[model samples]
Target chain A: MTLPAHGLPAGTLRRVRIVGTGLLGASIGMALTRQGIDVELSDSSPTAQALARDLGAGRLAEDGDDAAAPELVVVAVPPDVTARVIADQLHAYPTATVTDIASVKGRILDQVRALVEPRTLDRYIGSHPMAGRERSGAIAARADLFAGRPWVICTDEDTPAKDLQHVVDLARLVGGTPVHLDADRHDAAVARISHAPQVMSSLMAARLKDAPMDAVALAGQGLRDVTRIAASDPALWAQILDANAVEVRNVLTELREDLDTVIGALDGRVDALGVLASAIGAGNEGQARIPGKHGTAPTVYSTVTVLVGDKPGELGRLFTEMGEAGINLEDLQLEHANGQQFGLAEVSVLPAARGPLIEELRARGWTVPE
Target chain B: MTLPAHGLPAGTLRRVRIVGTGLLGASIGMALTRQGIDVELSDSSPTAQALARDLGAGRLAEDGDDAAAPELVVVAVPPDVTARVIADQLHAYPTATVTDIASVKGRILDQVRALVEPRTLDRYIGSHPMAGRERSGAIAARADLFAGRPWVICTDEDTPAKDLQHVVDLARLVGGTPVHLDADRHDAAVARISHAPQVMSSLMAARLKDAPMDAVALAGQGLRDVTRIAASDPALWAQILDANAVEVRNVLTELREDLDTVIGALDGRVDALGVLASAIGAGNEGQARIPGKHGTAPTVYSTVTVLVGDKPGELGRLFTEMGEAGINLEDLQLEHANGQQFGLAEVSVLPAARGPLIEELRARGWTVPE
Candidate 1:
């Protein structure tokens, strides 16, 4: 195990154990381990422990042995296993402060309250980091996974302030921005933003699967961009959606009503587009309200196509030319033939650069077809 | 006006007079004008015409008595102006091939079928290129706007083959892939894919506008990613939704039903996630069916983040390291932060390379969290 190297106060990080070596667990291990914290890893499946160990994420706990009582113990198991593990850990390591990182904190809190001793509740906090990846498993573990990311600490009225500080420090150690919200509010917010998006993206992506090949071929950046997150692991997401089915159902129902209103307008059943438009218009407004880095809105730019060769170094050449021209490209999209005979590359630049960019590219040997 | 430089058999591209100088109109002018085809630009606002002229996209057509007779005329006006302009053009340039590039084909086809001379109908071909941007107006136009994009040419039995060829040629000239479909199918497809997406994106974005700033501040790449397209011009989109109200409404209705099923599952009324999962699963299948460039399935890669300094040429230096390491990066996401601190530089690599790439970066003294 690595020692805390990030200049934390001495003895701040006690050797901690993450009970599951999945995406969240592995990520936490990596972050804490990187900060020079001693991390002990464990999982019910030996394969998970082996994978985490092989990745140098952390040392594995002895099979069926009570783990050394550490300062903090993160119960990063699946929701179905979360309460049971917290209850088990409370019985096994009564001296350590424990926390469970689950998407739905209320349900987990209820289960723990019913299952664990009352005194043990003081040593536990409910948290959820508003972050994730489409992929999972110990192989997908990452460190610094929480840096500048939101770590929602769902504190109850009974949560000890000192214990809260410990969790906050943990978030800081992993580079997460600690966000304190009530259990219900956190779940509701996630229901709207996180969980709802997952379902919507999945449904939308599924629609394209059966579409005609040619029509699907005509699918643009919009569809690809929107449904990118739909490629998540089905089994894991199934469990998550099943656990929080109620809240997710509510959001989707509202969305459906709005959709029907829009449809009704289209069918001349009522003057619905107005209402639909208002709803969607409101959504657009909401999208813009989202702060960019440092809490400012970044200007969105339009993409322009530039055709280039399929040969290696062609991309490098294009980037070099653009760089030399003093053009700051915001984003890029590339499309190549199956066999690589030809392709089109679309690069997005700020509005001010459009005219000069075209002239410069044309002056160079680039063939931008019209 | 410049003649089509790549001289076609005589009369390949007749003079095209566009009545609006917005994004679509200007794009068309730039495409046609670049082909050495003469385009006489027209717009209700002189400023639009001036903007197009400054862009060298086309020559501004003189108004009133000087309205030149065109062999082909395009009413690239908004949906609201479409029918009226078609009537106005029929009175002004009765001999020209008149067509409108409105998104919804059926309504325009239905509206104009009664007003224009029956013989003039042989000259028109309902056409729309499936390409767009978040911005609009003549200044946003590009000569290669339609390059390799899908251009739907809607036709009925009464439509002339010669007229179809003219539009097809126009599409080909602008580097677009022309797809022949009846107006109804075109409408249905657009309703399912394009229109539904717009409404969905707008709705999701709307949620953000009213969100608490602190909550909004916690927003991540996922929300920004999904709602990126929501920054579109609302008034224009409102007009578009109104134009295609029926078809769009139907799709939204179906979506509403799907949402209901989803909600039912949430309320434990049904297998909601399963229903959603099925729908979402369908989207996955559909997405996979969509052919990437040159009839290939796009291979998606996962991201690996490496902390890089926010210094000039830091990106170039990282690229140099990647090249030296012989890592083939499929994509790169540079997390932009306002402060002069470190940034999260995520590189997308094939699944096989994720671990090795991380190790290499770490060995190279790069701050890789994982």
Candidate 2:
């Protein structure tokens, strides 16, 4: 494949070996291969590696092949085996920089330190690309899986500058924007931002297990959003949660304290209203702090809700009209009306575009309620 | 305004009084007025009432008006004062059937029962329209606010058949699908599905208050979805939580028990993996119980994701292509690439159409990774 001119220059990463031909590994191989890099794929399961190779992720990595030693090795495996694989890769490719793509960094870093000598540890860097899909395995791999996603690189003060640059270059080559952080900080950040939220969602969803169907029938967007991640794979999450147990526990403990306060308030404690209000108010403040799309600061977009009929061509016409009007939608949310043959499409755009968009949609005979 | 033929017949509701011209009250008035009913709007705040009047919600309600006695009175007010208003409306219009649209029903029913005699109480029924917007007040009211949404009518064994029929008609006239539920059941349902989720979302979001900027920066769609409703109005939520404190507390206490188990598991308790797996597994089962769109049974739709450039008309062209290809989207989700001028549009279609749709999109020069 011809490399896009905007892609990595030819020699940035001439050859790389990716261990564990799973979703992340194979996807990295495919992306690098597309950029004119020689990517060698390997997995404990030969069939899995062959399947990835067949899918053009990379050529199979055979022993004693007539190829130059890889400049870098990417260890992409489950958290439980990540550390062991990194150690093996470091020993096998003595001259190569080694990076492992595990969601939890601190645990892997600790395990690696316990297993590898200090000199070998210098070649090992822990990284996590904050991108994934509900689906997994080699078949689900995509070349652009990491495009524009945060590829967090965890490094310590003892890390060699040249080695860090190699990892950063690999990240950029695959369309990732790398953010540097320490292993502990990365684990804690993910605990607060990702792992804890997953646990909370599952906990909330578990409550609905025995709920009366009538009660469940009343589920709305709020419940749906809160429980969406509850549908994640349990086995995978089990590994992730266990790997970062300490940090996850710390965050959950703090959450439980607040939960106790809310429970106490519900039990009619003194200043109950104050407790409830403060909890919700704190949420408003914290939720506002999350960055918006394009990794920019949080933006308050103006939403114009249009009534849409549930038909094949209806939404097409609506969006076509929006395009003709030259309004770039910052975001779009479609809410289906219960038991009706229609839905509400909430189109969010810059605040300045709200009035004009509403007027244009209305003029085009769409229902733009005042 | 000409009444649509599908609207309530003229004689069905000759006159209706809406007391409390907030979002719900004003919206009800506007819907009834459009259906050729004589809608008399009243609120404690004359400014709010007048604003509703000027906005075409209804004519102003004044003492000794020539209009015939209202056949019904809707008490649409905040939860704290809903019962008192219901009682007053029943006393003022002794013959009129009265209903209050408060989110929580049991407490209001108990309070109204305490404030009124049995005969007067028989004239009152409780209802909640499962519809609202982030924005409130008369100006934000839409005549179709309740369109195709569930309007739950809470009735008791003592509720008169005629009075119940009147409410059902009113709900239908406002474009709502009436759901029959008792006051206690309604409270419990909302507590489980709405109130408890709100508190949980707020609780989880509150944990992010002191989160390091880097931690918050790592926020992904999972965190975003879990905390979306955390931005809800605190004062309004406080009242809802307080009114249904018992039921909300019950659900939350159960959630806390599961949370404690997971925390214990994290603390290295025996069978920790089993406990964690079951917690997430239960969530999977519960989340699957939520009905899909149109209030149908949960149907798994195949998703076709396409990469669209971030510019005006890009999504329009893509969706227009699908429409022309005769594929109706079951759902659509847009995920922006962080710091990139492109986004992934995940379009969900019926399972049978996934392959054909993917092939069609690829033929149209859009990227569809296999």
Candidate 3:
């Protein structure tokens, strides 16, 4: 087998076993196998394991093969069955460093703690690689799925350093940046940033179900952004929201309090406008705190909107012009109006570059309106 | 002045007057002036009006100049003072067709009805152009701001056809697609499609205000989208929410009901998973119904993600290659991972083009994992 051009150095992980051949499992297997690590794949469904093996994720595992013992075991399964499968893996591979990639960590840790002995638990590390695609299953596996994503590794005071290092090395080998956090903190963080946002997006989109067609026709970019994730798989979200119910509920409860305040103000409170203003102002403050690209502090970029025909090669020409002008695009959004034959390409650049870029585009006969 | 390349056909509107030179008013002025229409500008702030005039939006209006009588008058004032200004302009220009571009139509219509005679009100048509910019005032105005956007015209049964036609002509002249709806219906539609989404976005973002930095650090694209519009102007949004309080509150109250149900299910209610699943399922259905770009039925596009280095002209090179391949991009989203040196450019195209495009991109030495 050919080694990946950027494969992990020698003396790293020699062999790994992934216990489920689903999307995450197959993807992890593919990444490790590409790095020249010996990866064995297994699944509850023989067809799935065979599919993953055929896709070059890894070789099919043979039961009772002590000669092929893995240096590490990765448990990738459904959340409801994750702890059980992790416990079984720990029992089956007593010498291997064990880890599970579960989105919600605290509850899984508690469940695993109850199912396994303390000594076995010392070898287990809980991690969550924050990467996924809308599609699932082995057919959707990718070797770079975890590339450039955060992989949260959960540990406590009792966790062994050697075992933790093995998991961290695996994360890096798969092209993920390892972040350390305790199980409880990781759960809280995911709930606040991911879980709560999903619930809110779904809730907002649900209101449009019975809305009049003309009303929905009036929908714009704001509505589109707020509800985009609502198209996520309901069964999976139900599992995730159920697992992190408490933290998700806490956030929703506080959001409801803010909603009530706005509702009450709109219902004609004494200082109605003040309450309304503060609600939106607080949002401004919070939104400004979200880190910008490359995890840097939020930087405000100046946007220049240029009109382009709705056809192929138009955007390429516009972006090529910007490139010729040596202005790097900080962000871009293409807005199409209802029944319009053209779109507005809102190109954001550094504040200092805005004037020159606009002048250059206008000189090149592109429409950059004042 | 030289005639615009695509000036409106002769004998449409000879002279028009605009009150309040904020973003909307100034943009309207600029568009008309570019179309070779005689636009007269006036604002409560002389500085704003002068800025708009100097920027070629229009010539400044002189008070009580009979020689400069306009064929139309557009009152583009703040929502709170919109009706008063509309009524005053209608009385001041007895022969001109007067219209106001207020986001909330019903309240302004009610107030104008209470203040003016039926004959006077017949000449006052309320129109709302669903277009805006993040920055306000004359400096941010663009001649093409309303191009290819929806311009809602609110008219009652008693309204004269002559005045309605004038507003429709103006909408077309400025490149807007005019949509006909009564005052109350227009208000309700905006409340559902625009105002309510803003309130929900702000409420979601407000929850992040006091969150731990670590928790906020875990923010992803989903969180960014749900709270993107939360960075909107508070004072402006407050006025909008207060103007359409009833409809906005109605939508929010129903959303709160769904939130309560989800909260109840998460509280360990019997069949909790069913409740949660249906909640997300309803969102999927509703989100599916939102019209795609160009106001057509939602069309699902297949996305191909390619790794792009974070630098100037990297995107230009990528798009230039796609252009060479002759594939039209239906949509594009750039995702940057925290602390990563590269970003993923998710290029969406027709399902028929996905395989060929991926092969083409991969052959060009771009990293496209499968």
Candidate 4:
């Protein structure tokens, strides 16, 4: 697929260098290479460089001793190191479109503006691919990593349209949807949706540390399900959280008030019920707004359970039947039978499909548990 | 598949009846059925009875109008009506073992005890399955719902050992792990793991209602992922929260204090950093205690994203490969690529297997992003 109006024409683009061999950088190079775009790769660490090369991400550039430049250089580095790298890149490569993939845009944009040349700054547009994994490093990168995920390009009037489009083209090449927003708005929005959830999940997970083993053992899918995000890389998150501290701090302040209101209501304070209820209600409201599998929020009919063996392919058979019958499963759970031959598989389908699916499974030699 | 002998083989048990056909009761019947035991099913609602029958959960006993004199009877009703039903059951079948499947045990137990005969009271044990879903009602019931889930049996010395064994048998039959705790302790524990999570999730999800549509549109997997539990039955949750008011109140108080401390830290309190750090650290400690798959916390390695078309079987192929490779995925997210050629499939798996899995996929001609 040709790059949208945002990508450089075939002959005009000679080199696209990615400066870090971490997950994001590796992923970007992989995607660009998949599109047959010739790209150069570089990293301070030789191990990272070797891994990137071995992974077919890109070949390391030769002119990387003190100062090296490529046609389009993307700085996919940690937030703390983003500004320094950008400034150094500006001095190193006088003619190249430079952009950095940083989680927090406002601080990075501000820092770069203060530390780098204005004309040099005009060539940069901040972008963040709203995608990630629990693991890090170039080894975890995939070529189609950004496909269909939002790639927020934070730009201002000073960001030349050509430069912005170039970044947008890069986003498109990786199969991402481009979302344009001001740096401050992007930071605030991410704080609410992205960063806040991580902190919340981590904090919630942390609460279990001192709980009795029994209580911890009794932890259901809900706790595991919610705090799953907490299993994220702590070091990487520390940088992201610290970079967006002001916005994250603001959001936490609001959440704190809401928590107090909820606690007050539970304590029998007047209207705290209303406050808490509204907060919960707000959460419900927000939850409902999220689109379900069909890219729309369908009314979840509810969930049902069926007993299946703990052995392999039990889930495969269950899901295969559901799919073959054209049933949409909204949510599912496998209640591990710690000491039994079978586990309970809770399946959530739309209200209408439950009966037929149950019936079909029963007919298929699967024990539908009377 | 026979019930494990706890005490006296539950003493020539004749029959155990479940008076509701919702998730808990149906699961009870299913578990018992698996153990070659049959449950007499009754529900005030005909639809529930029929649904239970259709699912082969239990046979509809002819003594429908009158409560049967069974060795044990479980009253699985909505929380608000649970106590009243238990009292009614005691009056109708004084010799039977009685228990109610309400999330909040203490309040219902207390109320039922005050209202039942002294002799009948001693035969009862209050239980709350630390398992449920965002959906409810009999249509959503599955016989295996409680497998490996916690069945909190609240009792005192006044509760006969025979009756307790019967209750434990019931728990075991349903493939649940039995935990014997008094009403208060059980309630408090539930508050920490189950109820508190629901409350928190609902409160957080509520905030998204008024978020800018664009911001809402940009809602990533994190928000959708965390708030998924908030889309629960509000009316039912209201009753549950109200029934366990004391325990719920106490937990919320603690959470409020923690929230305040977090907020205070964010607001620039001199000691805020330490407090915030402690809270987060507590979350870490708590998270680590949670057992992973196979009752041991497996190390979570990496999340790898695969971009695929939003057609049928894309996920199936992905999962099949992961399963075939003997790699157990811990979590998954399917980000629909805003009407693109492929969706971003992010799978969380053990870190050590990431390289092998990616390499395997690449060998299969699938575009393994760098």
lDDT of candidates 1 onward, in order = 0.72, 0.89, 0.87, 0.73
RMSD of each: 4.4, 2.7, 2.9, 4.7
Residue pair clashes in candidate 2: none
Off by over 4 Å in 4: A1-13, A64-69, A271-279, A293-307, A318-335, A338-341, A344-360, A367-370, B1-12, B29-68, B116-119, B268-281, B296-310, B314-338, B341-370
Model 2 lDDT on a 0 to 1 scale: 0.89
Which candidate should be chosen as best, given TM-score against the real structure? 2
Every model: iRMSD? 3.8, 1.1, 1.3, 3.4
Interface RMSD of 2: 1.1
Each model's number of backbone clashes? Answer: 30, 0, 0, 21
lDDT of candidate model 4 versus the reference: 0.73
Please report the TM-score between candidate 1 and the true structure: 0.87
Question: lDDT by residue for model 2 over A1-370, one digit each (tens)?
Answer: 5353454574446788999998899999999898878899989999999999988899987778645778789999888999999999899888889998989999899899999999999999999999888778999898888988899999889999877877998899889999999999999999999999999999999888899998888787788899999999888888899999999999999999999999999999758888999999999998998878878478789888898888887887888888899998889888887788898898999999999999999889999876
Whichever of 1 and 2 has more lDDT, that candidate is 2
Against the true two-chain complex, what DockQ does each candidate achieve? Answer: 0.37, 0.77, 0.71, 0.40
Chain A TM-score (model 3) = 0.94
Order the candidates by TM-score, highest first — what do you get? 2, 3, 1, 4
On DockQ, the leading prediction is: 2
Q: What is residue A233's positional error in candidate 1, in angstroms? A: 2.6
Error of model 1, residue A116, in angstroms:
1.1
Fnat of all models, as shown: 0.39, 0.76, 0.72, 0.40
